[model samples]
Target: MISSTQVVTLARRPRGPLRAGDLAITDQALPPLRPGDVLVRNTWLSVDPSIRIRLAETTPDGYLPPFALGEPLAGLALGVVVDSRSPEFAVGQHVSHLCGFREHAVVRADGATLGGYGGLSVVDTLDHPPQWFLGPLGSSGLTAYAGVHAVLDVKHTDTVWVSAAAGAVGGLVAQLSRLRGATVVGSAGSPAKVEYLRERLGLDAAFDHRRSPLTDRLAETVPAGITAYFDSVGGDHLEAALDAMNPGGRVAVCGAIAAYDAETPPPGPRNLFQLVSKSITVQGYRAGSYNDLLPAMQREIGEHLAQGRMHYEETVFDGLESAPAALAAMLEGLTTGKTLVRLDENRS
Candidate 1:
């Protein structure tokens, strides 16, 4: 059996923005597999904004604890089981897991859960590229599905505005909402992404959040006032949504990427009283909490994907060492769609 493997670890806590120097890739010895242990040779690693929250000295209460200094950092990953001590996982089976940031992981069959979703599960790679499970068909897809359908319960008559709409989950939420016949507006960080949202994704309106004031763009696009908002970027974005929301509007809160790297948490949107006046329903959730919806999500989203009604983009780094740089770029909004690291190039 292989002995040593390279794994990404927290060397130092980041201050403002994350730097590659704050993370370290170190060699570690793999322990022998016990009963129910599956040895996974990781191939793809997901780089998510939520991870930035845990990298801070403290995570939001009721969330996962922060990664200890020098501890191996983990996130969603895809891999093939190279060895197995349990019949539950056969050798050569593909699996989706949370024990990532390493070349290998010894995952338990009935292991700890990720958020609320089960941590380790077999994934069939027949109809799709395996890495897609780390993106649209897996957690990203699930998050979007939960936000757009479950939390927001978007209606066809609704004009929905999706913030960070060019991102992994946001992009999926935009398309899913559009497929449901909503008039969709999307906001991104760049002009090119805006074009993608307009021309490619065929959103009703698309704008660069960096170009002008957010309120002005919202007015320009949906002058009638959006009836629903899908928010991944919090802070000013949340406040702006509150300002632009129509009476009886609904908002889905899935992520807060805006102040993820800030030294101190940004204050809550000052306009929350708008909820009382406008009868707006602002609901925050993690996809894992809505795990029961996965089957429904997979069927609808998978059908849309197969029929060309949906689109997904990914930014993949070439090596395990690149994971840190990937995380840094994603936090700086320098990456489009889902950012990931390619660990095993030999995978078919």
Candidate 2:
């Protein structure tokens, strides 16, 4: 059994974009397991935008509390139980936990819930690659599923637009919308990502948001107006989506990555009045709040994967030491698909 583990901690609150000293890697001795605890060797760590919200000292209402300085940062992870004192979990069992950004974790069996956002549960790697649990079959996939199906109510006849469509959740959202028979348009930061959405993911149309004004590009791509909007990048994208939304349209506000690290708050959608003019329904949600949909999401997404009807991409950063860099790259929109840190490359 391992006696020590390396962990990444929040050295300090980031002011804008994360800096070199913001995150620190430290070695710590593992604590003795309690009666209900299981020791896990973490293999994969998911790098997500939500972690940035938790890094701030004070967050807006409804946001999770900040990560304590000098304490290990938490996210999602896939691990194998190395030792266990709990009957519910046994040694060699694979599990998911919110103890990522670390090489090992001591998790309480009772405290862990199965297969949803922020919940811990035993996972079966036979169905898919273990890392898939961190992306497609995990929180990102669940968020896309719930946002599109439950929140937005996308229909076969609907026309959909997704911002950050090349990203983890947004990518899944775009594909799922298409599977639902919606005509999907997507926006990405680069030409390559736009091409990825168009050629690889088979989005109906995609544009590079950096090349032109979003409103103009959206107008050209979705001239008839969109029936549903899955928003990840806010600010200009939100304003553009609002401008191009059809009457009675629905919007799932998933993330505001554009303003996540901004020192000053970005302006709200300038077309706020359009919400009333067009009678649009805009709702913001966190994936964790919709854990009730996990079972259905798992069944559907799993089937899609098994049938080769769906595809996902990942940008991997090897080792726990690369986690902060991977996170920074994700926030900068430098990564495509799901960004992850692999602690044990030998596994998968």
Candidate 3:
């Protein structure tokens, strides 16, 4: 068993964009285990856009509290129990929890509250890599599943548009929508990502959002107006979606990466009246609110994986020290699929 571990903590609240000095890595001794405690050796950590909100000095009301300066930052992680003092968890068992940005974690056998996903649960990766729990088979997958299946209710005849189509959640949204028989259109930042959406994910059409005006590009691809829109990038993308939405269209607002680290509030869609004119329905949700759907989503995604109908990509950083860069890359749109920090390099 390890006697000490390294963890990443916020050195200071970021101003505007995050900087290297804003995060610090330090080592400390493990606390002595209590009667109900379990010690875990973390193997994988997830880097997500939501963490950017925590780096601020204060978050909006009803949002998660900002990360305290000089304390360890947290997110989703997969680990193995190395030592246990409780009967609920045993050594060698694999589990998923919210103790990431660290090499080791000590938590109670009853599990800990992690934002909205509920208590930690034993995760059996089966024959797949344990890191899969941090990406396509994990929270990211669940988020996309909820957006496509529950929020939008995409149908075979519907035409769907997804912004940030190459991203972890948005990529799955595109694929799942296509699987449901919808005509899917997507937008990404670059040519490579555009190709990935078209050739790899099999979207009906995709274009580089940077190559032309988003409205023009979306209009070109979806001339008939979209029946369902899965939005990951807000600002102009949302505005464009509003302009191209069919009457009675449904939109699932997933994330707004464009405003995540902006110093000033981004302007809201200029065509706000479109919602009134078209009777559009727009709903925003967090992945945590749909925990009840995980089992069904898991079974469906697993079948897609087995049949080669679904594919996922991940940009992995080597160690805990690389986590800050990984987060920055994800926020800057430099990553594809899921961005992950792999702590246990020897495992795969």
Candidate 4:
């Protein structure tokens, strides 16, 4: 008999700050696997900006299902199959899914996908770790790649600006745009991140978003106005980007991290009329809506990773207990690049 540990919700409709008290760690008895069920030993769990949206009772446009109180929280997770009744997933394969934040999970086998994490496709792959799949090769990478290539339509001559430029998605967006021959500039919350973007990520130029008078900084840096804006931090950043956009520029609305945890919703852009005058195109994007483009994006990113054109870093915490702190760090702009939690590191 195997026991499972899971992170369960203790609150309903989170109104204010999410604390450690909102989650409960409990044990459960595992049920016998059915014909198409597989028992997964979760290795890494993704802590992304989207998870904060899941806590709300009302999701914008009903794209996300409401979270059930007392139920296990679910998001993108990478795991290994310790036992399986399904032939598609063998006993030692690494896989990922929208699985629970549990040490052990019994997933409906037919739903789990395969064939990522170093392309080794076996036990040897686990030696290298499968957590990377949740970042670069996983949904995060796809989101960044597609946002720049498909949605924003970046060109060689374009000047690209990425908000929240130190994040997993934003970092990749800047790298991809640079690889595509665009002059990329990024905005991060701190000077350290601004330095990482410039010196480490090789961004053409970078700025600290927290600096005084962003419009003045942007005007000084980009005298010609920004040709493309990959906006991850909305609100003031969005307004500044609008004010700096050249005629016929493009904006990819990837995320609004600046306002995600805000108690009061920020006002809409007062300069939205600039969109009309500048003939700018601003489009809100959801990665799920663009999954079909993942293959091409993956191909490009895989080649970039292989050739050293793109690089990523992650701040990983151990155990489910660290999930909340990791999330809070990410929201507070304390984490660099991607943030993840390793529950069963040895398993991976």
**Which candidate has the highest TM-score of all?**
1
> Across residues 134-220, which tens digit of lDDT does each residue of candidate 4 receive?
787777887887798789888899999999889989999999899889999999989899999998899999999888588887988
Worst 10 residues of 3 by lDDT: 111-120
Estimated TM-score per prediction?
A: 0.97, 0.94, 0.95, 0.89
Candidate 2: list runs displaced more than 4 Å: 112-116, 345-348
Q: Indicate the residue-level lDDT of 342 in model 2.
A: 87
lDDT of 3 at 39: 90
**TM-score, candidate number 4:** 0.89
Candidate 1: tens digits of C-alpha lDDT, residues 161-240: 99998888999999999988999999999899999999888899999998667888899888998999999989988988
Clashing pairs in 4: none
Best by lDDT: 1
Report the backbone clash tally of model 3. Answer: 0
Considering lDDT, which of the candidate structures 1 and 3 is the better prediction for this target? 1
- lDDT tens string, model 3, 1-348? 677889999998777777766899988688999998889888999998888888887776777788898888988898898898988898899988888899998877776565478356689898777787888889988999999989999899999999888998999999999999999998888899999999999999999989767888877887898988898778988898999999999999877777877776589899989999999999998888888889898889878977899988999999888888888788878999999998863642
lDDT of each: 0.89, 0.87, 0.86, 0.78
| Superposed Cα deviation of residue 324, candidate 2 (Å) | 1.3
Model 2, clash count? Answer: 0
Off by over 4 Å in 3: 345-348
- Rank ordering of all candidates by lDDT, starting from the highest: 1, 2, 3, 4
